[model samples]
Target: MNKTTVPSAPYTRRPPSPPQLPYPIFLNQPRRAGSRAEFVLTPSYDNVDPGQLTAEDLAIITQNQPQLVAPNVSGDWRYEQRREAQRILEFLYIGPHAVIRDHDFLRREGITMIVVARDSRLANRSMASVDRAGGTLGVRCQYIDVEGPRDLIHGFPQTIRDINDHLLSVYRGQMQEMDKNDRLLRKSDPPVRGKVLVTCESGNELAPAIVAAYIMSVFGKDMQSALQFVGLQRFCACFDENTKRLLQSWQDILRARASVARARTPVPGRPVPEAKPKRRLDQLRDHNDDEMGLGECTMDRERFLGRDAFVPFVDITNDNAS
Candidate 1:
């Protein structure tokens, strides 16, 4: 759907501490690493018969996989219908830019971080107040200086990293605090809580793309799964053909990287010697033009000029030659 049809945060009182969400915040955090292909293999939702799943494999899958259905987040009858920040996962919310300054909403939801992705062309008002609002609310605000929705492809990798890194760091800090407190009080550790809001002017294009990218990378999901999950929570989010193609390329890049990891991961009994460390691919590298399947229009030269500017080549060898 085009923007012609659809319609479109900061400042808080209370403690700077983020509130704990209902679901486990560390679902995507792998407990172990190296040659754990079983943990990283993208699940196939296809109609195929796997022999069976082991107890350990099943445990890992169940823990990491989030329920993709819309959450029963509130008692409000119109919660899903209203224009609010969608809790896509236990820890991630995707919604409009208006929530940045929403003090009660932020503290109530336990949101600690706000990621702003906007385009100048689509900007109707200045976002200079974003930082001031976040500061007041005591929320961390990170900006993605993108041209617009279409330009968000360039920021996907970094945005995903920013979100993941922050969440992990928050979890580690909580763990350290828990360890220190437990030594004296002998109390159980509380849940590690950190939530990041990914939003743009309307939460339709740029924000959704970033959310989908995060879901894809952190959850090892393909394009379809990621978008569907986001759309279910926030129906208004839109991705045009060009944006979809860009994500398709991004998925391809991720799949390629996952394959390499699988190969390097050691088998149960065998240990692979560590190779020299290489530069990390923290950015989504551009794939070939044909990868996006744009070659189908190569022969339709007239379409490029204008559909009405249709021009047929003459049969020079025949009498009908021009």
Candidate 2:
């Protein structure tokens, strides 16, 4: 009695029991496999383009499918491009930091910009030679000193804007022309001479992440697909688990933002229906014009009273009991 009997440890099975197969974890997944898969943006996000994809006709290539874009590209030229910088998108490339100095290769690809995503504090120091290299091409170079995961995530918006503005500079010029010449129409497609080269110290960790972010933003792809899209093209590019987690967080942020936008958009008939309650109230007041009236003014009668209106659920249990 003096020695309290310790509760026996819960009986443990040698092996954990397997879950029943009746219930599956996943449900209603979207189709991924196809030649020309279509993705629709939320109704609010697509004021201009219904969807988005980086096009080769504008200036594109597949990561694994090298022959997809320029079938006639000579192997010798391909080796030159692959030796230092590699093409990941129609207007985008990624490689090691040293590639910036390879001006001849840059000239060959017509690279208008070089985006350096540096991971070290020394990254803040400007590579002026690269700027001169870019100056010759008549464009400015971008150096983003994003060291850790947190800084990289925060820098996504500004980085994307810079890349997009540079890539579509010609399109913007064409739009300005259209604005100037209101009476007459012009050509359909403008020549896209602008191209980008993304680089990191090793061209493995951070650079790939940035390229993946660009793909995800422009193509509406998830984090995994975006990375895969890049990895196929740049085989040297590394995608560690931590980086995957980082991009998944970015994916979540984008999804939440899209949801908020869709939520804010008013339904097609909502505005017209909102006035229905007010109109109904006015009609009732007119019908009672000859009878005893509430003496409500025109403004009061015209006002819709549905703001913060709460209609409680009626309890049906008593009816069944009776």
Candidate 3:
């Protein structure tokens, strides 16, 4: 509940000028405006670009923005390449904040952005093909041709400008907030705030988006506040099919557990433990004969004669002979 925002990290280079407002987010309002839901298309689970959207996967895009529909066409490499470039531009300069939070250089200024024909998985082959075909890749585009980093990089350049623009807008606001620090002085009862949703292709979105949401939640028309803000829901892995399913399962489990926790009765006079008591995993491990889970008795031991059964045997014959 320490609501103070963490200080920005130190940098060696001179900071770039902040971006102009009425920026990217101002241009591309999400399909769901009330709560701000940004939908990005990543490739399917089996595809080399595990979290990228293919041309055939344009339905999700159109679903989010019906007025502007993209064809789900495949083949005709030339047309596909052009469409891909256009999609990249739309995502970079006009997509939602989630796009910015999940991307990297798109998060900074002056760095060159790249998008190659082959994601990391196909870098060598893609390059060789391009080399043989004698085609030009933009100076910005590099053939990654590998997985993970490569695919991410290819998709990443597609949205760098949006991230930079958003970052600049935020920094300028931060400076203003620091100058007039009036919002921090006042404290409201209970001190509860509403939730903001955070989504990314991976867990990367949680940190930055959470930070931004917290800042906005605190500043809420009062730029001077430094209260810690909490988001109600975080959707960090929406881009992948498997991750999407996992997120759904996690939601269900949380809801069920929360419902049970809320329904539980509090002990009238007993204090709840301040912190969870420490216990070692080794202590929880059962001996070979220990009853599993029920913890009633050892598996092979007699219950009634247990004490008598442990009695020591006497060597009476040896004593008599002596």
TM-score per prediction, in order, is 0.59, 0.57, 0.22
**Which of the numbered candidates is closest to the native, going by highest lDDT?**
1
**What local lDDT score does residue 20 receive in model 1, on the 0 to 100 scale?**
28
List model 3 lDDT by residue over 224-292, tens digit each.
Answer: 111011111121111233322322333343345444543453568976545567777545546643445
Off by over 4 Å in 2: 1-83, 174-189, 270-322
- Candidate 1 stretches with Cα past 4 Å from truth are 1-66, 71-82, 120-129, 177-188, 268-322
Count of clashes in candidate 3: 16
Tell me how many clashing residue pairs each candidate has: 10, 1, 16
- The better candidate by TM-score, 1 or 3, is 1
lDDT of 2 by residue, 1-322 (tens): 1232322345454887654222111122243564322222221122112123234412322222322221112212343444476777667888888888777888788887788887668675777667777677665688888767557888887897788777666444444343554743434453445688888888877888888887666555677666655665665566766677778888877777655554555678776223234456545455465355544453365466657654433345544678
Error of 3 at 149 (Å): 11
lDDT of 1 at 88: 76
Greater-TM-score candidate between 1 and 2: 1
